[model samples]
Target: MSRRLRLLVTTVGLAALAWLLLASIERAIALAERFEGLPQGVRWLVGGVLLLLVSLGAAVTVWWLRPRRPRAPVTAPDRTSLEARIAQLRHDDAGVEELRSELTELDRRRASARTYLAVFGEISTGKSSLIAAMVPGAAPASDARGGTTREVTHYETSAWGDGWTIADVPGSAEAGGEARERLARAEALRAHAVVYVCAGDLTRSQAEELRWLGDFGKPLVLAVNKADQWTDIERDQILQHVREQADGIPDAVLAISAGGEERFTRRLADGSTEDVTRRRPAQWQPLRDALRRLLAAGPSALEAQRENAVLASLHERTGERERAYRADEAERIVSRYARRAIVGAMAAVAPGSDLVIQGALAASMVRALASLHDVRVTDVEVDNLLRQVRMTLRTGTSVVLAVAGNALKAFPGLGTLGGGVLHAFAYALIFDSFGRALAATLAERQALDQADAGERMRELLNEVDASRLRRLADLTGEALRLRHEPSD
Candidate 1:
């Protein structure tokens, strides 16, 4: 709004508020005068009752409007149930041995009785310096440039307690450091406690990483490193802002200077300038105190949550592997069905008789794909799906035929293969479209989502892409060649 409009609204609002205040005062005075004539005991009792009612009402209102803490996004699945899922996935695809290894490591870590602490944050956020300060016995190299820590390094430190190891993980948000970020995150998950080091207020990515770590329900501390860079007042302000951004995610938010070498130019007696570097003393006592308090319960007491985090990570990794395996299997299944459709079309009695003849073949392909994805389907649903495919093919037969003709022209040699090659190619397109659509829908919805499948089928039917046409042409030629083979 314009300044004039804002001023007018403000003036009217203030005037209305003043009038309301005066009216309230006038009502209170009138009520007091009436109470003056009443018995003193009765008036006192009435006033007490009114005050109690008002207090109760205010308390209820405040309770209703209270702010609620946000729940974490990560959920730890039951260990037994998660193991069952990984076992079943391993049974289906033998490539998930790494997931099995993760479980094995989980058991090994639990048996070792070690408390792991991972320091995580963005690049050049003093994570290495913080680790160096936390563990006086070990020295982790720190640089002004970001991404100095390329690998996860564990330091055995007796400062906190025996069997307490701290991990110096690679900084996140570095240029082309996604793999290292993943490494950092995985290491963080393996730890019983995490110290998220930051030089200032939490960046958006830092906040998100903090939330992810917090969701695991681990002991997490948001440590603002390099506190010496700001004044005391400024440091407090930044800490408060970081706390607000972090909210209930971190157990505690503390500011500590992870002292590192400071570089400056020095002038000798001859007034010649020389570069000088000196190590600054670390002031990370607050962080040490916080971690001590967080880990006071010992490693064994925190093993359950640590296992849950590892299992949750494994579940996610195994799920990714399962999806990848299904995708590859779905491709093979679709190709096999498409080739069979081409052969069936070539063996048909009439030019377009394969449409009616291949109904059972199409239904079989759908069932196979659905079974691969663990989606059970009734025969009625299968038939209905095939019926929808038939209706879509009926409407787009001309487009399919046109695409086949174009493919024949594109590959002149295929045109001389046989008289029914066009029909064979069209059937290849139809079944290819149907199988791909069903596979995608099954993978996405894990159900017989007929509408979504039909829509995808329609789109694929009209997709006369060069690669697809070439593949179908090749399949049609192969089918014709196999049809003329001698019966041994």
Candidate 2:
């Protein structure tokens, strides 16, 4: 019912109810007055009966006028259905399995409570020295030769009661370095932040390597080691060069001398040992402070990285699966339309009837292919595609049989049947070729704009083999004969 009509009906019914209620009260008062001359007990019983009837009437009216709640709408199981589809795709696709493994490992890393900071640099870049300076007693042997650290070394410590790990990975410039580089990159991928150490100004190759590291989307700190060897002016120049090479991605660039000069203990003439201090390099306090600031940003930074990585993976995998499903559906649609076109061609009674039936069939197939990709084309677009296919077929070798079929129509009796059969076969071949070409375009996610439609359609039609057309025509002929044959 309309809102105005319902309101009018409700108002009228309420007014009538109010009038009835008033009349009942008036009647009860009149009856009580009449009973005024009766016994007191009789008057009391009459009053009680009238009160019960009024209460029952009010209850009925309120129950009938109460508001009703609307029912909830049913929703599809999107998440469950998607999960099932993903599982099936994974079972059948190797790429999906690889992506799934990567996502699973990423999830595990995100769940870890401890933070990792990886130290990355080329060989002899003071990586070990910088780590030793920050860690005090946990110093590993520092060698000038390359490949000093062949495996990842973890140094665990507590700062402000929170546990943190520093990973010293192998240098990327070592002999047989491809494996080491892969391992170093994998370690860096799992780190919350990276501290890149360098001895002096960066070379062109080293600068490119730093840029590659920045692509991982983690916080970075650039630490220039062995600053004691460079003069103040040279140090400033080196720092500026390093900053330019870091591309504004590093949170901080710090200059520190991780390798202090050698100190010796000498025996004095009185047989006591004396300590001698030589040229002592500065401590790595600046690098430590920079790292502490990055850590202070807390777990939200790592969580954001995880969210981005997972979202990217989900989008890529979902698109791949959706395209695969659409491709399969497009093939099914083409096969269905091809069969229908064949049947329609076989039923043509006259030479010219084949054109009308085949034209309609081909247009339907084009629209069906577009629907598979969720694309909408105008009537003009469909007509253009059909015209292109028809023109191609008329100019190609397929034209000879079609022309001969039309020529046969001049004869009577058996010649009409033969001409109709020839026309139907030729039309079926054209429709089948057009459908396959359209399906290929949709599968490749190509747009059906006029600019490339003719060229793309011709290229696809040329790829259709003559043998396949002949085989399809013969099969259609046999199927039509079987369907029309009389049964015993």
* Best-fitting candidate, scored by lDDT: 1
Error of 2 at 364 (Å): 7.5
**Model 1 lDDT per residue over 312-350, tens place:** 787788789889888888888988988988888776554
Q: What is the C-alpha RMSD of each candidate to the true structure, in Å?
A: 8.4, 25.7
Tens digits of per-residue lDDT for model 2, 46-128: 88998999999999999977753322212223434444556756366665664455556556656756677789988888787
Off by over 4 Å in 2: 1-90, 101-103, 118-161, 166-190, 196-217, 224-232, 255-284, 300-302, 313-384, 395-447, 459-488
C-alpha positional error of residue 208 in candidate 1 after TM-score superposition, expressed in Å:
1.1
| lDDT of model number 2 | 0.66
TM values, all candidates:
0.82, 0.47
Q: After superposition, how far is residue 103 of candidate 1 from its true place, in Å?
A: 0.7
**Model 2: number of clashes?**
0
- Candidate 1, which segments miss by more than 4 Å at Cα? 1-65, 70-73, 88-95, 139-150, 348-353
Query: In model 2, what lDDT does residue 467 have?
Result: 59
